[model samples]
Target: VRQAMVLTNNPDKLRALAAGGVEIAGRQALYGSLNDHNHRYLSAKAERAGHWLDEVLDTRSSRD
Candidate 1:
């Protein structure tokens, strides 16, 4: 299934799927903020939930 495949490939999508399907608001919420708050939240989700957040995680490490 395309939906399942997409979900498997994308951690954000997986989360969206789990949270009663993805909506426009979900997309906006994810990219709405680029501050530490959103960054940390995304990092935690990646580490704890196996989300594909390499781009954000890599940036965090580089900043250190």
Candidate 2:
């Protein structure tokens, strides 16, 4: 059997943003901002990957 984490909960797909790696609004060049305008850019990728943006966003908010 696979081992699970003993300290915290895990999400469907765990990902690490890494230190100073988050770009939420042109604030950083990595993602070039994550505001409304630049946010929709993920729709296509998410659709292709068959992922739910709502669920992802909800999860982020809850975690924060």
Candidate 3:
């Protein structure tokens, strides 16, 4: 797990702005097609960057 302080210090407004129009957008057209390298990259981001990628992956799995 990453540090709580780091997680808390994230630029929430910046993320929200950057995610505009895509926060809940399905990843079917992109993430669904990730090759090994891409998948590993996303996994690392989820682990270190505290991205919600694991939850996204889980949602995809549940729908499969």
Candidate 4:
């Protein structure tokens, strides 16, 4: 029999799902630019998200 799978990017949700016995197949790639900003404000969202991605994947190496 084939098992069901789930895909998610949120770390908290991923952890919760895992705790509930959901299998974590792997992490999906997320891409964004630190340079991408509006005239109102500069953002580091991409870098922050990258950190979270690394934490979830438990890898220190870069993705892609």
The best candidate in terms of lDDT: 1
The numbered model that scores best in TM-score is 1
| lDDT at residue 25 of model 4 (Cα atoms) | 73
RMSD of each: 7.3, 13.4, 11.5, 7.7
Ranking by lDDT: 1, 3, 4, 2
Inter-residue clash pairs, candidate 1: none
lDDT of 1 by residue, 2-58 (tens): 233342425556566657554323222222334676887877777887766676567
Across residues 21-58, which tens digit of lDDT does each residue of candidate 2 receive?
A: 43222111112223556455555545665444554444
lDDT per residue for candidate 4 within 1-64, as digits (tens), equals 1222445445676676778777777766453342224211222232454234434233322332
RMSD (CA, Å), candidate 4 to true, equals 7.7
lDDT of 1 at 46: 76
Which should have the higher lDDT, number 1 or number 2? 1
Ranking 1 against 4 by lDDT, winner: 1
For each candidate in the order shown, give its overall lDDT on alpha carbons: 0.56, 0.37, 0.47, 0.45
Instruction: For model 3, give the 10-residue run with minimal summed lDDT.
Output: 1-10
Candidate 4 wrongly placed segments (more than 4 Å)? 1-9, 36-64
TM-score of each: 0.43, 0.27, 0.36, 0.39
Q: What is the TM-score (0 to 1) of candidate 1?
A: 0.43
Number of backbone collisions per candidate, in order? 0, 3, 0, 0
- Native-to-model Cα distance after best TM-score fit, residue 18 in candidate 4, in Å: 0.6
